[model samples]
Target chain A: MTLSKRIIPCLDVTDGRVVKGINFIDLQDAGDPVEIAKNYNEQGADEITFLDITASSDNRDLILDIIESVAKQIFIPLTVGGGVRSVNDVRRLLNAGADKVSINTSAILNPELVKESSARFGSQCIVVAIDAKRVDDHWEVFTHGGRNKTGLDALEWAKKMVDYGAGELLLTSMDRDGTKSGFDLELTQQISDAVEVPIIASGGVGNLKHLVDGVKLGKADAVLAASIFHFGEFSIKDAKEFMKNNNVEVRL
Target chain B: MIAIVDYGMGNLKSVHNAFKFIAPAIDSVVTSDPKVINNADRVVFPGQGAMPDCIREIEERNLKDAIIHAAQSKPFLGICIGLQLLFEKSDEGNIEGLKILKGNVCRFVSSKTEKIKIPHMGWNSVAHHGNHPLWANISNHEKFYFVHSYYVKEANSEIVQGQTEYGQKFTSAVAKDNLFACQFHPEKSGSAGLQLLKNFTSWTC
Candidate 1:
């Protein structure tokens, strides 16, 4: 019963600008991370997740600054992931006021890292993120920013992580990453059904109906998207209203 | 003035923001200080995260007695986890609650439906059960944003002001003399949510 339907907004931070794309292409600057997070906070976003999508060293510093600035202004729970590799990285983010630290590449490289961090900081603070791509009709776990294949089945890895004491699972489908078509329901359902912890479904969110579908059909405890929210195409308020109309319970 | 209890749990800023939007003149502060709670015109308890942690923080800050006193003396508004804590106890943990409202917090039984999910997160319609000032300007069938798996099952149904249907109709809002609560997050709720805050602010009860 720890699972709550979460309406989350994802911010892709690069060089201090919030950027988003389809399949990680056609990159465009959306807005300031601080400004966007503030708006989402005011509009009632359950949580805000920031993904450091940039590779530049300078952008990394900028992302940290963005986190610090946004943390000051926002009061809701804030989660930051991407390019996070060590406990130091996690500590830095937490020191910057991040409520939860999400790990993807590091967890895939050393699955034991999930257990180690969970043991150190408590399970509720550790969020293991998984990126998957369809290979030979089988969902394969990917890492290194979704650019490399791990040759591991997504569901198997998710179950393993839970056994390792990861508190929550953040599952993102590479194929659907930026298409805005909809969430990969089959992938999301597989992880959700396999794991006991809360699952956050990310990738391919187009509109409010897709958000509702993510929770209702995909069985996700929360839905995360970047483009739709950053571009002003859909708002957290309108999205929650649509979910209400459709019978998807959100905190109003 | 509204004293927002700071129990080191989920977002209290958004709750304060909602109050600011609705009643700009309403004073709000996040503090565990008893003197502040005693001085406020009203009280708002908004919760996020776990219930056990919230209860512990309230006790650690020595605000338990103050919260109970405030509930007994002035208007109180509890939202989400805040509402769940008002009950007799919660299955979330073995910790005892404020017992201001008579009920036990239980998990949503979604096994009854194939489509319904737990954590019942999102916006859903609230069906009014009784006339309360908190419902003023809030349509009977209007929607509110909810994000929890557990709800209060009042020992006394008379305290329930609204109910919502997910797998089945459960209490969405409850009211007793000088005390009110909603399982939904009125701050996160949009315009209608703001209206509820406004109504609560202006209510004489």
Candidate 2:
């Protein structure tokens, strides 16, 4: 009767293509967003998240087209993040078939967006993404894709976002972004404890044990990984199997 | 023909697309027109958002009578907020419901020690009651994607077909006559969900 700890495979897309160097040489078109998403779906990944790293508005239509095709084929839940700045962006993505819309910069620039959008579209569909990095004794919230610091405490910002009607929190550690070390367990645990809503630990997941530790130690409801899965280091099945063996319930 | 009643609540694309993926040849349309809902062989009332908002939109569009008629006559399927609306009333906004079933929708409560989160999101297993047609080919305790805060408390226990536990046991799915509803989204629940949707397409009850 317990809820399974989710294992989400995030696809970093730039110019309508997967940005990571995938080692799936067997895949004819490894960088294809739809193909990669479909591959993860078949691998039993709990959910598929698309982080649109494309900054140019000219390529917006490409992502939408990709989302439409993937949503048509994939039966599981789809989450879209990155460059989502307004309610209209959320609408466009959801209409294109995203189950949840994650907001990072917009939410920080205008905190009301989280409240207003969640009011119109249920809170269940509004995910507030917090990019934070440790600053001495406490963690500080960072924005602009973890490039700038906001001087705001990460824990305080998380609780405030929940109050502003964020259903879930996607907590990413800037320090661990491409380090391949593991998740910032202390940060994840603090956010999980600070708020009642579910929090997903992201940024540093080098191996299968990291996934288990993300849930077991960090108390995170889900774990989001990119390069490790993208580089063919390990499959989602291997991660879930390891988690299940370690007594962490997961959807096999 | 299947008419998915879309009353400007949430995205009906995934639900519509799931039907298209299952039986490509079938005529499935997302329509707000009550006439289309009435004429269709089957009706799917799928929605998400606040209960009060859902109620306002359904009434403003003059879909109240149409939805009630469809539920009474044909194989009507209610999903998420749709399922919550079928009950007598809801704790959310203290609003009235469709009253199609003898039940009430109540929010999940948490204590100091056990802080069960609201909007019970993510995958959880369902314990089916018996050999229901919807449960056909699906194993017992199969996991389905769910995301909601409030849950139904059906007065008639016999009508409760499926149950799931979060902080406590709640009715996840219910079936009575031609009416079938669930707290989880079968359209977004992957294979097991697709199987449930396929079952609904051929469901004669």
Candidate 3:
């Protein structure tokens, strides 16, 4: 069936609380990850992504509990990421109730991890989150939670990640993240067209209309945002209504 | 009692939790034992991952016969790979399937000039072909969460109970006698998903 463009509310968790910042820095407490995720579930969010921003920086056991609680209450799809290094980590997260497990630094560090995870858990459960920035006219990959810039090109990496068996790509614009300016249409569109896998456009979603633009212009299968849905600037329901009214198919 | 056939594939936790949430009184178990599956009041075969691995595990565990018996004898519900494996064979891994239904599974490719994403992952709507108890309380055009690249390309028309449009119209659900299988995941499909589980719990073949 022709799937509607998804509206995903992302919860960046650090120390078990959903945190937000400007461009992945200057962190501040937003709310309990489980509670906020439950709210989005009731509001008809298509999916929920929980990124343990400090997964590598601290103990990894913390987010598993949150994932368990959220997965129980939120019956939709739950994708958990950050600090995932191996297939064992993906197994532990899935056992804890995550429908999909996202890998970032590890996928970049060891692209074979993507192939391994996809083979073991199935490609449908593996997501490769790429944080990229526009350098001149080309997009370059970033690592360490979007702090360190990798010399790899964004489009080429996306294609490689897919070939390695990543079922979906969660592409974030490092430049526009938390800026709420809107998605990087050029970067998002470039990767979207290059890969056959579904692309979830994350970062820079200020208003409801930007969601429509992400699908209409960027060709993203889904649009993900942080501040807009987290702080109640726009409810997921409101965004779906706006998209439906604008002729962009969305779950209401 | 509902037995969720577990060959070490798919989201057994969510499927079990969904059943528990809908009908707390109903007993459910996710097991690989043929006896438990064959003895259950209802059977649900939920699957994910590659078809070849799923088939290998089923063969290694020797649960294929029990699954076939359940499908023929009781109310059976297959989800995603659970549904795909029922066909005769799949293009993926170029492997044989259960051969329960006369069909072939193949990957989704765009027929039009526009590009269509493989692994049609996300929420989408399904159009039911006929009225059935399993669809009880669920809207015909209800949206459900789906994540799959290969789908049943050919199957019996009488059994094709629902269809959905992606690159082109294709089968999304199937039903015959006591069997009901769908491409979308009901456990991950939110409220409508919960309702479908509830219907399955109370439904009598």
- Most accurate candidate by TM-score: 2
TM-score of chain A of 3: 0.92
- lDDT (tens digit, per residue) of candidate 2 on A76-122: 98999988888998999999999999999899899999998899898
Best candidate (score: lDDT): 2
What is the per-residue lDDT of model 3 for residues B1-205, given as tens digits with 9 covering 90 to 100? 8999999885699898888788889999999999999899999999999999999999999999999999998999999999999999999999999999999999888766878999898888999898888889999889999999998987989999889888878899998888999999999999999898889888887
The best-first sequence of candidates by lDDT reads 2, 3, 1
Candidate 3 regions exceeding 4 Å error are A20-30, A55-58
DockQ, 0 to 1 scale, candidate 1: 0.11
Model 1 per-residue lDDT tens digits across residues B1-205: 8899887775466677667666778787888788999899999988766788788888898888888888888999988888888889988876678888788988766463444544565567788987788898888878676767678775588888888886767888888899998988777566787888888888787
Q: On residues B1-205, what C-alpha lDDT tens digit does candidate 2 reach at each position?
A: 9999999998999999999999898899999999999899999999999999999999999999999999999998999999999989999999999998989999888866687767798999999987788888888999999999899975578889899989878899998899999899999899999999888899997
User: What's the TM-score of each model vs. the native?
Assistant: 0.75, 0.98, 0.96
Model 1 C-alpha lDDT per residue in residues A134-205, reported as the tens digit of each score = 898779999765799889999899889878867788899999987989999999987898766778999899
Off by over 4 Å in 1: A1-10, A21-30, A33-50, A54-103, A106-128, A160-169, A178-185, A195-201, A204-252, B112-116
lDDT of each structure?
0.78, 0.91, 0.88
DockQ for model 3 equals 0.75
Greater lDDT among 2 and 3 belongs to 2
- Give the root-mean-square deviation of each candidate in angstroms: 5.5, 1.0, 3.0
- Flag the better candidate by TM-score, 1 or 3: 3
